[model samples]
Target: MQETPFTLRAGHLLPYCMSDSNKTDFTNPSTFILLGIPGLEAAHIWISIPFCTMYAIAVLGNIAILFIVRREPSLHVPMYYFLCMLAVTDLVLCMSILPKMLSIFWFNSREIDFNACLTQMYFVHCVSVIESGIFLAMALDRYVAICDPLRHSIILTNPMVAKVILAVVLRGSMIVLPYPFLARQWPYCRTNIIPQSYCAHIAVVKLACADTRVNSYYGLFVLFGVLGLDAIFIAMTYIQILRVIFSLPTKDARLKTFGTCGSHLFVILAFYIPGLFFSLMYRFAQNVPLHFQVLFPNMYLFIPPMLNPIIYGMRTKQIRDRLLRLFTHKGP
Candidate 1:
C-alpha cells in the first residue's frame, strides 16, 4: 500500500511516509494523534489558561443553572425547564472534549483511541444539535408567554415539555449518528493524525482515504437541516412576538414584554451567529492560516457555553436575585 498522504504539521503542509512495517497505521490505526493547534506550540501553554478558565466557568455556571432550576420550586415551569435542558446540553458539549483537550495542550498527551475519537465526534455534534433545538423550544416558550398568556401553561404543560425535550434529543442523535459510522467505513491510509485538539467531524472525515463527496453532502444536509429549519421557525416566532409586543397599549407594558425576551434574543444570536460564521469560514476560507483554522473551531465550541449561563444570570432578575441570595446568605 502507498504511504500516508500529505499532512499538516506545525503550519507546514508536508508529505509523510509510513513504510510497510507500520502499514497497519494505514486503513484504521489503533490511535489518532491530536496536534493541538499546529504552529502555535509555544502558545499552547498561554492558550490553555483562558481555555481552561472558560471550561471551568462553563461547567460551574451550567451546573449552577441546573442546581437553581431544580431547587427553586418557582422555577418548575416550562422556561426554566428548558433552561435546565440547555444547561445540561452545554455542560455535556463542553465536557466532551475539554479535559482531553487540556491534556493535549499541557502534557502533550495527544493520542486518542480510534473508537474513542469517533465517540467524541458523535457527542460534540449530537449535543450541539440538541442545543439548537433547546433554543427553538425557548423561543416557543417566549412566544406562548407573550402572545397567548392565558393558554401559555395549557400549551406547554409538563408532559408537553418532556416530549419536546425527547424530540430534541432523538432528532439531534439521528442527525448526527451517521457521522462516526461514515468516518469508520472509509479506509484510512497512513494518516491517523488530526490537526485539531478534538474530533471535529469534517476533520475526521477528510482524514479517510476514500471518496468524500457523500460525507460532505451528508454534512451539508445536517447543517442546512439544523440551521435552515431552525432559523425559519425562530424567525417566524419572533416576528409574531414582535407584532404582539408592539400592539401593547402602554410604553411601559411594551418595554416590560420585550425586556423579558432580551436575554433570550442575545443568547440566540450568541449561539447561532458564531456557529454559522465559523462553519462557513471552515468550509470556504481555505487560504486562512492554520492557527486560525485551529483557533476558531475551539472558540466556536466553548464560547457560547461559557457565555450562556452568564448572559442568563446577569439578565434574568430572578436568577440574579437568587444568585445574590446564595452568596449573601439571605432568605428566599
Candidate 2:
C-alpha cells in the first residue's frame, strides 16, 4: 500500500488520494495556528509597538475611571455607575485579546490548544455582547434623564442599576455560550490556521470540517438579536431624547440635555460602526485580502477599549474633574 501526498490548497491540507466513494476522513486537529497579519509578518515588530501602547492606555485609563468613580462621592449616580460598568467591560475586553495578540506579534507564539481557543472565543464574544448591552443600558439612562428628569432617580436607582448589570451578564453569557460548544463538537481537519490574530467565532467556525451552517446562522442570530436590537433601541432612545431637547424652553437647557449624552453617543458610534463594518466584511466580502480581513477585526477589538475612557473623560464633566483632582491633589 502506498500513501498519497497531501497538497496545500487555500490554507487547507487535502489528501491527494480519493476513493470511488468520494469520501475523506478528517481527524480533529489538536492545535490551531493564528497567522497574525497575512503580508506584514516582517513589520510585526512595528505593529506591536502601537498595539502595546493601546493596550496600556486601555487598561490604565479604564482603571483610572474605575478608581475615580469609586472615590468620588458626588459621582455616585446612575450615569456614573453605568460608566463604571463600561470601564470594567472595556478593561476585560482589552485584556482578553491584547496579551495574546502581542504574544503572537512579538514572540511569534501563535499555536493555541483546542480548548484554550474555544475559551478565548467564548470570552471575546461574551464580553463584546455585554458591552453592547451596557451601551443600551446607558442609552436608556440618558433617555430617562433627558426625557423624564423628574423620575430619573426613582427609575434608575442603585438597585435598578445592579439588576441591569446582572441582567446584562446573564443575557450575554446565555447567548454566547453555545458558540464554543457547537464549534467544539465539529471536527477540524483543515489546516487549523486561523487567519486572524485572535479566536473570533466566525474565524474558528470556518475551520471546522463539519457543516457549519447552524453555527453561522446562530452567530448571525446573536449578532442581530443582541447587537441589532440594542442598536435599534439606542437609536429610538436618542430620537426621543432629541424631541425632548428641542422642546426645551431655552438654548441653554437644550444644550445641557444634549451635552449629557455626548460621551455615550461617542462611545456607541466608535464601537458599532467599525464593529458592523468588520462583521459585514467577514460575512459578505469573501474576496477581501487576508490582511484586511485580519486588520479590520483587530481594529474593532482594539479601538473602543483604547478610546472609551478618553471619550468619557473628555465629554463627561464630572469624570474630567474627578480625574484631574485625583491626579492633582496635594496631601496634607
Q: Compared with the true structure, what per-residue lDDT tens digits does model 2 show for residues 121-213?
A: 888888888888899999999999888889998999899999999999899889889988888888765557776677777777777777989
| Pairs of residues at least 3 apart in sequence or in different chains that clash in candidate 2 | none
Structural similarity to truth (TM-score) of each candidate: 0.93, 0.91
Query: On residues 98-188, what C-alpha lDDT tens digit does candidate 1 reach at each position?
Result: 9998998899898899999989888888887888888899999999999999999999999999999999999988888898899899888
In candidate 1, which residue ranges exceed 4 Å CA deviation?
Answer: 1-25
lDDT (Cα, 0-100) at 294 in candidate 1: 74
In terms of lDDT, the best-performing candidate is 1
* Best prediction by TM-score: 1
Candidate 2: residue 111 Cα off by (Å): 0.9
In angstroms, how far off is 304's CA in candidate 2?
Answer: 0.8
The positional error of residue 223 in candidate 1, measured at the CA in angstroms, is 0.6
* lDDT measured at residue 313 in model 2 versus the true structure, 0 to 100: 88
Deviating ranges (above 4 Å) for candidate 2: 1-26
